[model samples]
Target chain A: MATQTTDVGQAVGGAAKVGMPQLDFSTFSNQIFWLIITLVVIYFILSRIALPRIGGALADRAGTITNDLAEAEDLKSQALAAEEAYEKALADARAEAQNINVLMRAEIQGQLDEELAKADAQISGRTKEAAAELAEIRNAAKANVKVVAKAVAKEIVAALGGKADAKTVTAAVTERMKG
Target chain B: MATETHGEAEAGLVFHPMDQFQVTPLFGAGPVEWFTITNATLWMGLSILVIFVILVLGARGRALVPTRSQSIAELAYGFIYKMVEDVTGKDGVAYFPYIMTLFMFIVVANFLGLLPMAFTTTSHIAVTAVMAMAVFLAVTVLGFVKNGFGFLSVFWISSAPLILRPILALIEVISYFVRPVSHSIRLAGNMMAGHAVIKVFAAFAPLVLISTGIGLVVTPLSILAITAIYALEVLVSFIQAYVFAILTCVYLRDALHPHH
Candidate 1:
């Protein structure tokens, strides 16, 4: 405790110094020798253990950072790929929907066309039958008119005091109608 | 100015700032032997222990997300590592451990010295000189071994004009030899000067008890100066360590690539 005022002194009191202790040649070897030993010990400890450990820690941090960045980049690309696939799928679904619409429209049109064609066929057939029936009625009416005219001619001849045969009257009437 | 007696029956203010640098045996007062464990040894050993705890033990977790102490350890490691790689190039990374050892030791020793009444090991010329000399000798040897005679090209600046090349080489040689001396002195001088100045200011702080008249002015001023200087010393100590390490890198670069 008393000698605590050595160079690494605990003593704060002023003890007179002779010349410069640094310039004092007697203590040079002691300081130099100790410094050498301190340095050697430090060098060995650092080289053997401390330096490598610290260096490895730093390197490990860098590697971890790099790996984390790479993983982030990879995830970003994957997200991009997923979005692209979703867009493609969406586009495909839209196209399929349009295709189904076109197919449905065409089928409905074909069905409508078939119904119109069948209706046309049925109407034409009914018109032809009706025309034939009108022709028959016209013919019947003409025959009836001719018979009535023959009867009337006969009655008129009898009333005018000129007696004639039924066969003759019929013949006359038929000739008139022909003219 | 040295000690002075002011009045009878009163202890005059004593300020022996240089006395703080005196080397003495930690055990007992006697002649310091070459192997005697002095206060210098105690502080150096303490610094090593500090480094071990902060670096070796602190980084033991090897966490991807570092804790506070681990962060400091990794920060120092990365700072010096990047500096070495940048200044010394890729090949110089192999000497990172040695450089880190020097950096940690010096910086830790310097900060430890700032503690009240603690010995400043790095302030000693003997200590810094050895480190600087070691760097110098290692770089010199490595240069010679690696480049052989080609290492001489570092001194011979072929980029200069023919006439100036010899002069420049002479200058380069002198500068190269002076590197160790300047490197060591720069750290030691800065540490010693700052501490001594603080001690000087502290010695004046007692003026308040001695003479209340001047003490009123000198006491506050001296105290303020000590505070300010103490803060500056903190910055200086760290800077000196960084300077020393970076300078080592520069020297290593020259050795590895002596041609340029």
Candidate 2:
């Protein structure tokens, strides 16, 4: 079938009769001519346009990757620093709370001590006043007892029908109390 | 492709494997003039168009995150660039575009030729020879320019004993001159041989229709063989292009550093 299609062109000269078409020198010039044109065209396309564009693209990609990696590294370091600052702030807040607790406890203790001292002084003063009152009552009772004794004696004497002087009776009662 | 070969199905098994490689005009049954737009021109032109599409238009989107075709373009560029740099060293990076041109052309052309009934342009000696010769001449001239008369030291073996140096030099000189020949023939031969072998196996595919007994075994075997060979050919296509480019770099290296 290939021969049938290509068979149409064998009607030229007797020199076309050859075992291999590759050895056919007649087509060399045509092949070489076209080949040169093709090579030159390809060369220009590659050198002037295609290769440089590809190289540029590859280089551009590499540069972009490098820049991105560097930026990522910078962000990572920044995050670490921020974490350190946060930890320090937390520790500072805890220390401040501790200081406030100690100060508040000391201030409360001072107020309690002052209140207790005032109550103790009031109790002692009241006790002394009560003791004085008690002593006065005892003295009054003792005087009353003597007077009653003298009155009873006078009544007895009157009942016996011997009317005597009050002065003398009082003197006698005083002497009995002394003895 | 199966339909294309079916035309000769009725005429019994006919094997014209070499006919696929013939260089004929795409238009009429006329002479293949130097300027004539033959099948060779069609395929070569197609190769150029493909290169333009893949390397130029395909990679139009220069995205930081690449699209499919854009990545393909970058992959090809890096592959060739690395090859040239590895084989020819840093100074050879200047000629990266030229080496890239050859690599892209051959690689794409070879793959295009893998299509059924498609003309394999790299299968021709004329085409591969021209490319190899271009590399050879360029390297030779660069050697002379860069190293002056010291370029001849490439063939001279300094490490060898003085008694054996002449013999080593003689061998090196022959091998140096043979670079272009081996380089061109190797690519063309691999391509031509693979395609011809496939065609031969394809011719045997219709054996089942002719005779049932032997055709059962021969037909299936040939088809399987075709599959296997086609797979191998695909590998060969890329490898051949790689071999060509690497060889070119090796030559360039020798030219640049002509010593040990």
lDDT of 2 at B200: 92
lDDT of 1 by residue, A80-153 (tens): 99999999999999999999999999999999999999999999999999999999999998899889988888
lDDT of 2 at A86: 100
lDDT of 1 at A141: 89
DockQ of each: 0.44, 0.40
TM-score of chain A, predicted model 2, versus the true chain A, to 2 decimals: 0.70
Task: Kindly report which residue pairs in candidate 2 clash with one another.
Answer: none
Which tens-of-lDDT digit does each residue in B1-260 have in candidate 1?
Answer: 12232351025556567667777788876678899878888898999899989988988898889999999998898899999999999999999999998999999999999999889988889888999999999999999999999999999988889999999999999999999999999999999999999998988898878777667898999999999999999999999999999999999999999987
For every candidate, C-alpha RMSD to the true structure in Å: 4.3, 5.2
Listed per prediction, chain B TM-scores read 0.95, 0.95
Each candidate's fnat:
0.81, 0.73
- The CA lDDT of each predicted structure is 0.88, 0.88
